[model samples]
Target: MSSTANWSYTAQATIWRCLGRNEDGILTFDRPVVIKCDYGMNARKGSLDIGRECVIKNTIWTEYGKASVGDYLLIGKSSEADPISAGAEEIIHIQRFADTFERNADDYALFTGGD
Candidate 1:
């Protein structure tokens, strides 16, 4: 997935916490994904979470290994996405794009407890 945020300070851009805080799902690809956030020098308000349904379509790469999710992966977004704390009772449901490895249109993941 790709994202952009414009902030003027080096603050907490995104706070990522797992859904179940218990399970780390599957690893499907070979190349690790890259989330390039071209924020301003002092951008203070921008962040994202790796909760679910995160499809990597571009050719970005890294020496680090790739990450993956299991069946029914999901993600949610807003004009604004952020790092937050939540309980496991509610899972994150994310949608997918055509380039995604999955033939379906959605992926979901759940995170519980909090950081």
Candidate 2:
């Protein structure tokens, strides 16, 4: 039997950047995925056992002290953002933060904190 289970997770952006020229705009980020917590009643150890149709709440990205809700969906194990193996024992949350930025002419906005 496949041990892999579907889990829902939330991703929040610590720092977000955008480049715009006139009406055209581009959204970019250094590291935009902060897992707040797992959603499920069946939890084991420190991770939660969330299988199938996971829901994430309060998923937003922040910039210049301003935050915008981010749209994302948990695609079980084996995702591009974070990879997981089937039949995994535990599901550890991943948290990432932006420390620095690259030089560019585009406008940059620094996120202070949560919205």
Name the best candidate (by TM-score).
2
* lDDT of each residue in 35-72, candidate 2, tens digit only: 32223333222322444333322222222222232222
Candidate 1 lDDT tens digits, 56-111: 32121211111222211112221222222211111122222241443332222122
Residue runs of model 2 more than 4 Å from their true location after superposition:
1-24, 40-67, 71-115
Each prediction's whole-model lDDT (CA): 0.23, 0.25
Error of 1 at 11 (Å): 15
Q: How far is candidate 1 from the true structure (C-alpha RMSD, Å)?
A: 14.4
Residue 31 CA displacement from its true place in model 1, Å = 20
TM-score of each: 0.18, 0.19
C-alpha lDDT of candidate 1 relative to the true structure: 0.23
